[model samples]
Target: MSGTQPTVTLSGGGADDARTVVRALEGTFGAPDERPGDGNATVHTATFAGETDGSAADGGGEGAGRLSAPVTVTVQGSPEAVRRASETLARVFTARDDGAASGDQEQERELHLMP
Candidate 1:
């Protein structure tokens, strides 16, 4: 926790969306250190310290250290929220041009909650 911790920001969905993502992350990383945003901009943010369960020694291997990096997540809402969320989100999520592009190219793309 010396340098800047990594962060993951998600926007455009809503407050509920932000809560959903926060819940999902909490399930894996335990309680976060900071939960800013809230109703301030319909935006929400959560920060977690880098930690691991030492499962690597138990042969859990590879991705076992997923939480080894500090992370901050934000969901979008208001205009300001959208701007900030988008900037941070871009750092975590990126556009992948897989060549196999298909479907209605005219349709606007937004974040969708998955089951």
Candidate 2:
């Protein structure tokens, strides 16, 4: 991993959406380091080190070495999270976009989901 971990900041989603996004992220990168926010807005920040799946001890089984680098995820609240949640209102949702929503150069780590 590099000295600075990559971070993904999702903002504007409400509490429910925040929870949904957090759950979806957890499913991918594991639990977060810090989760703070309310129904109005929330923020979830987590750092993923190595493969989240417990396959390293199994001689690098399937899906192993997929996330060799560390990555960070920060889910903001209300609007962003709401947009993410709406993708699949039944359960959690993880976006597959190129992270290009607001014409930002650092789109790989920054995303602004829409409802």
Quick one: best TM-score, which candidate?
2
Clash pairs for candidate 1: 11-76
lDDT of 1 by residue, 12-86 (tens): 445555554544444333345765344645445565443235332122122212222223343323333323333
lDDT of 2 by residue, 1-115 (tens): 2211223454455544444444444433444555445645445443433223633222222221122122223322333332332232222223343333322222232433433
Q: What is the lDDT of residue 14 in candidate 2?
A: 53
- lDDT of prediction 2: 0.36
* TM-score per candidate: 0.37, 0.40
**Residue 41 Cα positional deviation in candidate 1, in Å, after optimal superposition:** 1.3
The clash count for each model shown is: 1, 10
**lDDT comparing candidate 1 with the true structure:** 0.36
Instruction: Give candidate 2's TM-score.
Output: 0.40
